[model samples]
Target: MIFTIAHKEFRSLFSAPSTWLILGVLQFIFAWFFLARLDAYLQVQTQLAMVANAPGATVSVVAPLFGTLALVMMMLIPLFTMRLLAEERRNQTLALLLAAPISSGQIVLGKFLSMVIFNICIIACSTIMLSILGLGTRLDFGLLLTNALGLLLLTACYTVLGLYLSALTKQPIVAAMSAIALSFGMWLIDVGSSDSGSAMRALSPSAHAQSLNSGFIFSTDLLFFALFIGAFLFLTIRRVNNNRLYA
Candidate 1:
């Protein structure tokens, strides 16, 4: 049943023209940035060869692309997630799900899974540009793997938060705006940090994601995203369960 709902949700996303448009535009931007970074790397190759243990194309071009995609995901995830529950509620469809035999957890998990799957596709598309560097240079597969992992974890965080915010209101645009505002706020916390242990920085997903982006994986960073995603999903379940209770 959970798989059924998740599959339905995934297909429903593609049913909209905007989903295709977003993916197309995102890939185009990623390619443009990639070519620019590659061109810059080429221009500096001679200078870098004279330096000791200079960074490679993987570091100079590929890694930064993933980092850029992280910021893009921050802005775009809410648009995909805004309609998850908010649209259902707005269209008077949430009531059917609430009254069904399925638990709120199943419903929430299903929706979250669908969003994760969709975003994984987005990450994969962005990573394709990174993979192209292997044709001309020795790519750092380990670094690429870590960067992809970091983006996936960050996407999970954004999806959970967006889903929770989507549950709070029936207005999809309101949910999108609120989610974007909150995400951008946390991103600011990461940007303003001077200390690694600062409270605000610790709460920012981007702070942890940066470590993985640099190919350094810390257990604490992994735990932070796990707890962050779990807490939000739990809260979403509670919110939807309350709606079921009232119904």
Candidate 2:
């Protein structure tokens, strides 16, 4: 049942021309950044060769690219998630979903799964572009894998957060803006905090992702993402159930 809803939502997304347009623009930006980074790495290759333990192509190019993509998706995902439930509400179709035989958990999880699957495709595409460098240079498959894992978790965090916000309002634009504002605020908390061990900094998903971005995977970071995603998903499910009860 969850997969059924996910398939319907996934098909609905591709059916929209706007999804294709967003993908085109995102790919163009990613490619431009990738080439620019590759060129810079080539220019510094000789200098790096002389320095002991210098970062390789993976560190020099792929890491920054992943970081940039993470930031970009932090803002971009809300645009896609805005319509996940808010648009249905606005179009007066949410009532049908709420009244369906499926549980509220299924509805929320299904929608969340659809968005996560979509983002996995985006991440896979970006990783494939970065993999092209493997032909000319040795790449850190470990770092690449870890970074991909981090970004996937981060984007999933964004999806669930946006899903909850979408359930709170009937206006898709409002949901998008709220998600962006909240996400940016959390990012600011991570950036502005001076103490590395501060509890406030620990609240930001970006902070946890940065740990992975550095090619080190810690269980704590993984726990943070798991908790963050789970909390929001629970909230979204609760919200949907309330809507069902009222409707």
User: How well is each residue in 1-247 modelled by candidate 2, as lDDT tens digits?
Assistant: 9999999999999999999999989999999999999999899999999999998999989999999999899999999999999999889998788778889899999999999999999999999999999999888999999999999999999999999999999999999999999999998998899998999999999999998998999999999999999999999999888885775
TM-scores, each model vs. reference: 0.98, 0.98
Residue pairs whose backbone atoms clash in candidate 1: none
Give every collision pair in model 2. Answer: none
After best superposition, candidate 1 residue 164: deviation in angstroms?
A: 0.3
Clash counts for all predictions: 0, 0
**lDDT of prediction 1:** 0.93
For model 2, what is the error of residue 162's alpha carbon versus the real structure, in angstroms, after optimal superposition? 0.5
Q: Kindly list the per-residue Cα lDDT of model 1 for residues 46-113, writing each as its tens digit.
A: 99999999999888888898989999999999999999999998999987888789999999999999
